[model samples]
Target: MKRSKQWDVRGAVGFAAFFHFLYSCATGCLLPFLTLYLRHLGLTAVMTGTIMAVKHLVALAWRPLSCILARRHNKRRTVITGSLVCSAAVALTLLLFPPTGNSTENKSCNISQLNNVPTTLRPRTTLQKFSPSVRYSAEHTINPIQKHNSTEYISAVPVNISTLHNNQSTAETTTSSRSDGKNSSDVQKPSAGKRSRSLMKREQKQEKITKIQYQFLESLKVMDTQQQMFFFIMMIMILWEILAAPLTWAADDGLHEYLDFVDATERHRAVKPWKLLGAAGGIGCSGILVSVLYCLIGTVLHFYAYALLMGLAVPLAALLPLYRHKREHVPGAGVKALQLVRGDSQAMLCAITAVLTGMAGSAVSDFLLWQLQDHNATELQMGIIMAVVPLCQAAFAPLNGCLSRLLKFHGRLLPLAILGLSLQCLSYSFLQTPWTILPSQVLAGISIGALWWSLEAQSADIASPGTELAVKRVFEGLYLDLGAGLGSVAGGFVVQKFGINTLFQGTAAVLGLWCVTLAMLQWRIPRQRRINYSRLLAADASEMSESESEQDNDWLEKAMEEDKGNNNWRRLD
Candidate 1:
């Protein structure tokens, strides 16, 4: 029996780790390239920003609701598996709508003619309207003439002019003869109108042909396709996010519950590092795979890779050893979570810190690729930079556990993590080359890891039994969804207006100020005034006992009498 139980534990941990690894593999494959794919589809920076912002905003509202429903129905495993399967299905659907336009043709044309156009003519609307036709006529009229000598070209021009004159005279003579009974003025008017109409028709035909050729040459067809599909894509992405938003939270919560059931709660930290390691491996490997496939096939296969990995993870998610607790519906769970946040100063501070950190992180993640591209970084270089972050995170995952323990005693890690984030943002502002940004990612991994660890620890300290999931939902909604949504929208506008550099600098300044304020508040607040779940739980327990309830009633009456005598209860802090 003991051997079988041990085997069950090993299997549970192995399956959990494998599931997380696969899930991270899918996420890493998809997210890093999603914006790039949108750009490839010919979306503008602002449009991409809006789509990303909407995705986060939807997650903010949906994550908590999904968690609540899952818990209430005791379907945590079902939710995880369903979300993974649905998200993978959606990801695979993307392959059906490949981006339009031929990049090679556009490059060839742009190099031959468009690049030779003067900068002054580039921005003129009229030039844009007429340049294609002019180029088409120039190519056709000049190419054949160039094949002959200069004498033949010069002689050919006069012959063409003489023939045009002869045709015009014949047409006039025919018109005059036909209208001999009519007045000369009336005959000339009809002839002139006919000539103008014919010329207009010819010009219209030429213009249509030129426009089509230009669109084909410049690959603007891609933009047209994107415009037509933009709304559909947005809806698909929103649905994907709605399904994906609660997955990590649900998995973590279920894992903890399982650990509690198995009397192995102490191993929670050890188990968590596996997820990080999986994430690191997934991100690094996916980056390499994408770069290799892009080079060899000149096509993106990441979406396919994402779908395969996520599909594989679904079965593992179903097999996870989640311990579902039997409980009646508790409608006040959210209310209690809110009350805990309000009562605990540390919890309130943690929430604010989460928001600020999320905002800064989103701004950097969403726009840094654009900056790198502007500096002419290649796909491989960008992949390397992205892979470095997760690798560093995985490398430092054990250190994070140790730091969480040391900082839990004094509750100093959150503020320090915020400070580290500020420094990272500041470093981003000064980036001169793509490779120059690599060092900053070390700071990024460490700070973000520490920030999340401290926030989780603090939340655990404040949450009572039965309110854990609700409390986690509140914090994650604030951090991942609300803060990130706002940051994406604002970052888009800022990058469009002042540029990405300014956006980074401004975010850094705001984070630095917030970090200082948090540190100061923590230092100034008295320990006695700070609230924790232990005090609240003790008071509730005492209230439930008859003797203690009577004693509390007597003490309350005495307090009321004192308040009546001195009005101390009404005094404002």
Candidate 2:
């Protein structure tokens, strides 16, 4: 039985990891570089933004539907189906993409461009940025990216994702502040007196810097795991705009497409392009062969045509997770414990991530499309700018060991990382046009790195000691998916209503609030009482300690008895 269970764990974990990686590559990696693709396809900024944002809405809607299907049928089979769906969507999008429209003819694209704003996002984040326990008082809700001049004092923090990208800790390298760059909150404050710690008998007082560090560390520790997860998920969605959102954001080549369409119309004017006997849908192509071709060829394009491939990636992303599932397995003990977290945490993360993805991605795409509606950017230039964040993050994340060593502890590391990202994002509140969005992508790597590190590290701390490592990995996966779903929905709506810059600042506000929440949690929720488990799961730490001591004494007594018996026999002999 144990052997079977062990095999199940190994199998489940391996398959899940495979599915997740494939899904991630298809969803995040591909989409991160999508912004430039939509521009090449004749999409206007608003149209591109809408396409990017709307797709997320579809993907978000699909996540639960997919979840349900997975539950009712074989989970692995469902994931497999999902992966195929992504492939199909990619093909369909490519085939249906309209030919150039006529300039003289009245034409409309479903998506529009929004200029005067910058930085779009993609839909694929997996969780929130902070724990739920952290709450922001109404006081810190300042929106730096707002048009109102009152809070405009907060200068935009552009992320140079290209900076130090060669470093292994992508998060550490990217989340840094510009040397002369100022955050909205960097205004000098009245100095506080020094303090002393009980741990150190020295009479030396605490420095202001030490106080901030202490407060910051405490704040980082206090955030509720749930809230942190929420913030982490949301932040990733916001960062999603770093690249792919631009695919939808660039200025529409309406006239360019119209000219091409006019030429096509002229060519076909003499004899209509008639539908062939075996034509699939409205296009003259076979469905089966076409789909397979897209899946195979699309993967190829995704690797090579960084800009053009995103249009395909948007739809394809929806399906990859499904196929990857066939490879997934659950650990022996985790299968049971995961049951406890199956719906609540998973659902919350997915829902929030989707909404945020839409919010950030839609808004930024709109802004960029508006900026580029005249089509000033060449595809290559846009692609490189969009490419920076993911490229930097991918390069840096693996070097977490080196980054961790730089920090004194995880508490310091995670929060500093979070703050650095927030500051990087906040920098965008006041930057000028054109170059505005470009710099922020660099920061995305750091923000994403910080958010991911905190959640994975903290979840490990929270999981039951008996649970296998697989449980936490699953926890990370589910939360990430949920967050991605929710972020898309939220991001889309927010972009539609508020401008893209507002969405960016709005995200910063959320991050700031998360910071406050962390502080509150640290102050109130004592370090010993981290997870507030139900009585059944909450094994009192003191009780466990006592039980362990008692067990140890029993073993000691048994050993002493044996030793004494042996000694007596030897003495008698």
Candidate 3:
């Protein structure tokens, strides 16, 4: 029986890590480059922000359904279906809308040229400078070679007009002979008026064509392309949300539930939440690192093959969860929606923290990309610079976890995470060169790793028995989504107005203030009053006698056997 429990634990954690890695890999490949891609397509910063914000805005409506699906059906099946759908939608989007250098400008200009200008009305100022012989030859007696090369007429007419001007006395003699007693000035005046009128008409035509081109370029930069691209992106984002939300929600709830179960089975606290969360973070970091490499190589080479390969990674990683082993199921699903009204201080804190984290994290990509462009970093250097955050995260997360285990302190790490967040913002704000990006990324890794592990475990511990754990998880997810959306839009405006460095400075200031406030509040709260998983799960921690324990184990096994055949999901009241 103990062996069976151990196997379940190993399988669950391993599968969870695999799922996170694949999800992150697919997401990393596309999302980090999404804003840059849209800009490349000629969308302005404001438009890009609005479009990116929509990606997260969908989560507001979608997150609740994720909880419902996870609770009301087989989570494994739900995860698989979601993974497949998300994979297909994302793959189609990238493949169909592959990037082309200068395609946007070329397309816009082509349309303008077709609609706004006439082919025959070439701007002809140079013709007035031609001498009589050359001008006559150019206009009336074209050589076969000159006819073959139409461009020669332009240069020939200009030089001949200049020569004709130099021989003005001969031109006057010729004109006087033709005039035959009529005043030459009188004959030439009307012709001069006609020439002036013709030049004026030509100039007006040229100005009109220039005006049309300018308007087309402006429209391409600011408005309509963004609208078209927004709708296109929304189609993909909606499909992605429909699938990814449920699977991710289920995984989050499952991991937390598994932790509770582990606590119930072990007499002593053997599996810590920090270690579990850190491992997940580590896997995510590795996935992002690989994703950045692929994105850089593909983008620089201007090929979709590398990105498509990354998109294909989604389902491959998803298959791990479908391994035909007995999955650990946590019993009881009730009205967790009711707990939303309970207004627990701890839950509120967790939700607020998630929002801040989302705000800080979501816009970091845009800022980093902006910095790379400003500094003129190469594609490979940009990829490595972008990858620094995840690498640092992977290194520090488990280190923090191991430290937590050794120090026997979990709540204490929350402040450290906040500190890391503050430092990251400062680093991004001040650092100008590629070399400086690494230090900031190290801070980011620590901040993100610590916050995710500690905040989640803390949120779960505060929930009462009647609460739906899935709902609790979804609440955090929703806040994060909201924050990210708002941040992306706001960051776009900030970058447009004050530049990327200012955005980083403002972010740092906001986070530093938050860190100080969180530290002060944390200082006031007693350690025992705060969350501890062991204490929280210890309600079912009572020891049974040897014979009773055997009977309980036998009953649990029989119940599991019965449940194997009846896999109906429970609904919350």
For candidate 2, report its TM-score: 0.42
Name the candidate, 1 or 3, with the larger TM-score value.
1
- Compared with the true structure, the alpha-carbon lDDT of candidate 1 equals 0.69
**Off by more than 4 A, model 2:** 1-30, 33-82, 99-375, 402-411, 429-439, 465-498, 529-573
Candidate 1 lDDT over residue span 1-573, tens digit each: 455544366667667777776788778777876776665554556777788889999887787788777877788888898888888787766555544221211121233354556653331111012222221212224333133322222111111233344566569768866777566555577777897688667656765665565554344322333454576688888888888887976887777677777777655556656666666666566667655544333325577777888888877776787775554555788789889988988888888887777788788888887778777766567777877767766776667657745653436777777888888889888888888988788888877777777777666777887776678667877888888888888888888789889999999999999988988998887543335557677675544879877887999999989878676556643
Predicted candidate 3 versus true structure: per-residue lDDT over 95-115, tens digit per residue: 344221122111112334434
lDDT (CA) for every model shown? 0.69, 0.40, 0.56
Ranking by lDDT: 1, 3, 2
Best by TM-score: 1
For model 1, what is the alpha-carbon lDDT of residue 111? 33
Worst ten in a row by lDDT for model 2: 271-280
Clashing pairs in 3: 129-161, 129-162, 130-160, 130-161, 130-162, 131-160, 131-161, 131-164
RMSD (Å) per prediction: 15.9, 31.3, 16.8
Model 2 lDDT at residue 170: 37
Q: Rank the candidates by TM-score, best first.
A: 1, 3, 2
Q: Model 1: which residue pairs collide?
A: none
Top candidate by lDDT: 1
Whose lDDT is higher: candidate 2's or candidate 3's?
Answer: 3
Write candidate 2's Cα lDDT for 248-277 as tens digits: 101111111222333431221111111111
